[model samples]
Target: MVDRLFRMKTKSIFVRLPLLFIFFDAVRCDYFPTLYPRESETREIKELNGLWNFRADMSVNRSQGFEEKWFMSRLEKTGPVIPMPVPSSYNDVTQDKSLRDFTGWVWYDKEFFCHYHGKDRGSYTGTVYWMITTNSEEAKVQVEVVDADSNTVVMGEGIKGQASVSNVKLWWPYSMVKTGAAYMYVLKVTVKDSTSASTDIYRQPFGFRTVNKTNTQLLINNKPFYCHGVAKHEDYDLRGKGLDMVSVAKDFNILKWLGVNCFRTSHYPYAEEIMDQADQQGIVVIDESPAIGLLQQVYNLTKALDPTRLVTFASSNSNPLSDHVMNIVDVVMVNIYFGWYQDTGYLQTIPYQVPPTLEGLYKHYNKPVMVSEYGAETLTGLHTSPSFTFSEEYQKDLLIQYHQEYDKLRHEYLAGEMIWNFADFLIDQKTNWAYGCNKGLFTRHRQPKMAAFTVRERYQKMINETQKYQN
Candidate 1:
């Protein structure tokens, strides 16, 4: 499998998908991929992902687990046991449908071997970090790092926090530093046993990396990074939004193939595992919240969890609300569908429409602006005379115009331009929808469309031009 995966290059960027499934399959553990080290601390990250001892209190009326301190692992033998897979939804794992829907407190238990070696054992330095997620306001979650004697090493409240300790390790991505091996630590997430607590403890394994921004560019570990990828959606047949490792690995491989360096989680945040994989591959992700009905609180939370990246809402239209929201964000982004959805489908219209939108944003906000999305839906193999909607030639030509206009503006005010999607994906079947939206550079199964080559060539040229000017 390792030999089957090869490398592709475009100018200076070396693109390769390091297939780690060979080791992942053997160990049955998933690595949580957040770069959490603040440079002052070295941390050890362990993904408690495989089979965990699970007990679901379906009674919908019990609360004794919290009062009795069930999170301490002392009550391991107090309930019926079933081996549950970590990093998976507990809904479809059982034969009983009620168990799938049973929303009470589900207890998960796992023990991992931790090694601490220091001559001065009293001053060991380490920290335990994990992400705690919940859907209900009434839900209560707690985490504890315990020793063999059930002594609490550290404890915390809320969904995601870090508990500092002594004598630990640091995680590095394969792309960042190839150490030939990866190390991790263990974490336990628990909740109160009650009808109100419909809880699932997910396994998160993150490493140490820092994200921050400059006036004109994004900085990873203090180095400026230019995003050159597409807006991606979590849509696939059969699985829908369910976590499928195969599709994810394929997506990473395709992103590498494009020679692009980054992508935004379009519309919403992606699965934790996907973020982990992105971390492992060193792919920069512009994590987004929901499109509409979204609150500033959501962006606040995302920024709080990952402070290295900026949070900007994708504004489609110019309005007071959007203008007000953009004022509050770290960056300004707009999703314009002009020349396809609004204006005439003419290339000349693009130059007129795009520049003013960006210039207006720059004038008012004085923040870096990016074209988050801009594309026309084009069906594969379809052609048209003047480049009409749903035609491959139209999609190709429309992108060509948009890119040309963006090139002229990017140097001045625009920071990046992410095409609507990398691939055509599953969508709700409706009257106006043609099978699925064909606005992708590739088909749903990862087949390249005409626009794919167009994008690749344009990206390569852009990189070469930037390099020449920089030199």
Candidate 2:
């Protein structure tokens, strides 16, 4: 069977699919592609984002779809099909319970025509580093830095060389400083192969800034930085982690309104479109990998690839004293739910439970620490006077308790604090979950709960303090 599978002739298979799955075998490189897609004078990108034919392999062995070569024909012709939106988790889109709970091989395919479109440019100043990969190592590569406003070349006209920009506008997080701004510049790369008579051009947008950490603080542009932010998931009503621009715009607006300057992409990286907004708006991102284990390898490879940024993992381990990976991280990020998960119903225990753990980690490693995830589940509209678990007041008080502890050590070794969730998100049905994890400051539909107001007030105060310090 293995021999027969290997002997099968390779054939072209074109179908509507998410851009994330599209792979080009022609281009190869050592580093992972972290660049966001952009249209340029020589390059174009067409979004294949819409409804696609979908099917779940329900056969006895769950190999029927692959064995029948379903990719060669329309999915509907092979079996009963459903219209599933691209860039979304198919689990929660349908009303059927089986589909919502399905865990198996699923297929999605779409067909469309390609067209050309024009591109626009933006302006900024900064030191930008770029990398390119070509099929042939001998291909001539040229890079240019273009001033978007004047349409003039600012720097770079070489095959391989470094270009420096003096008096560069450094990118800063929102309200990180009194005069902070998210400035960006355009980089144009061109590749030509004389033998193949082929030419390709691509443009990338990047910013210049410095990020480093001391024993006590995280610094941006040589100034102390604090993350008055929340950990967010790429999830929404009906979409289930799908890329939705409307939701993205609304979320950014809310982030600004709540005075949030930084956010950790909890559990995994977010959509490239969302990242572009973060770059343009000067939002600090703690990018995270999808995998949970093998911290040493992940940390080393990430640092090697992008040494400019700090690398750390969100550890759920309560006992940090025994964490072997603590020394490997740039920042010690711990997700302790002392009040909520451990000593349940004892909100007062937070102050007592949190300090020792944080202090121990800092004393052992002498590295900056952050409360990467901490929150209590609270159902919206559920209220109680004195506050108890699963009530709105309890969630609000839990965050308040955590903040109070964080404030005590913020000036010493505490670097930042991020609440577990920015908004409510869906999860597999469990007895403990109230519909889903109700730990979000905002409800799933982006509606604010009582905890939202509490967080916003604290974050706004932090922003004011940051501005005052900058002055």
Candidate 3:
């Protein structure tokens, strides 16, 4: 859920030695896990989505689990255990108040039966290629293309491939043009071995889209695109970061109702299931890596691996004029809290301060600029007439100010604007966090505040304007 740096302290002097060794070793490690798991004809997947035995390390030093080797045996054997959901956060599942605020290693145990099949084993080699099939009613065509890594593949190796489809339907954001739907094509891959008479087939669904950027515009499929979006986190009431299909469907439905076209996975990559829904719903995603604070290295490595998509990091620095990494990024994304954090209660100064900052960043970098984050924290059901801080009115008024500034710069260098949050989420208790950050346009339960209506109106207007222009 929340991103925070952890520092382990102990009386032992050898702790630093192993940590330092790990730090250096990690720099040399280049292998990264597959982003998403898939099932093919030859490969099978089992869902581990039910209850599991759970226990938290409540010892004084919080190292009792490691000392007792709790993972080696059932959690109930070591002590009394509770049933916790596998993909959910362990914090908010019980009645104990201490468990809700626990910050230590938690152990989980699950038992499942897997049947092993014994077949004739031999050296297996295969040729893998891609077949693109159109699933639309208006068009039905299939084309075969060679894999980028060529046709040859060993038994345990993965192959990379790409193909071009002619007369393809482009993936568009929600209601961008003619109430467009997310058009995706099936990429069927077949691996065949002539000797073993073994074959594997996998079908991957992907949308045919291209992203580009000019000095003052962000283009999707070579058409100018605007992001009337929000930054989101995977937090829920009792489920926390758990994978719940009901919640996922509800969130996507609300996003459509709000006329939102895009969203950024605030500080890290989201669950693959959420991404699948994004593709199906035609929502643009600004996918982010985990928050490690190495933007330049992340940019370089990601660009080197896949140079097709535009890459940019969200800058929280108030002063963008002196930002050092602006030149290396594809777009300038700044999380400016002009009225909320900086000016603090001075809502009138937002218009004066925001425009100059955006202009400065655009002129300096000569790239498209975006206000990736801007919002005020307002408690649900709290209201004040004159737009005082911590009131719903203040939050609504602050967003209006930011939108005013965005409109002035939209056609020039401002490419997009995304509010700070889509909904309220859980975080560690702190001085500023009342339960958690209340900056969301909607509450933690997905109930809209007054600001949500404002955003919806503005976004719908933008969509209508874009549609008219395209026509």
Most TM-score-accurate candidate: 2
**69 Cα displacement, candidate 1 (Å):** 50
For each candidate in turn, the TM-score is 0.58, 0.72, 0.67
Q: What is the lDDT of every predicted structure here?
A: 0.63, 0.76, 0.71
Model 2: CA > 4 A from native: 1-126, 147-153, 157-159, 193-198
Displacement of residue 15 (Cα, Å) in model 3 is 57
Give me candidate 3's TM-score against the actual structure. 0.67
Question: What is the C-alpha lDDT profile of model 2 across 144-246, one tens digit per residue?
Answer: 7754232434556446566766555667786776553776766877787866443777767777788998999999878899888899999998888888755
**Which is the leading candidate under lDDT?**
2
How would you encode candidate 1's per-residue C-alpha lDDT over 185-289 as one tens digit per residue? 435576654573434554345443445565565554344445677998898766676776556655775675575566888877899878866764556678876
Error of 2 at 302 (Å): 1.4
lDDT of 1: 0.63
Arrange candidates by TM-score, descending: 2, 3, 1
lDDT of 3 by residue, 201-254 (tens): 454666556689889999976789988899999988788887786577668767
Error of 1 at 459 (Å): 2.9
User: What is the number of backbone collisions in each predicted candidate, taken in the order shown?
Assistant: 17, 1, 0
lDDT of 1 at 399: 90
Considering only N, C-alpha and C atoms within 3 Å, which residue pairs clash in candidate 2?
A: 16-110
List the candidate 3 regions with Cα displacement exceeding 4 Å: 1-162, 196-198, 291-293
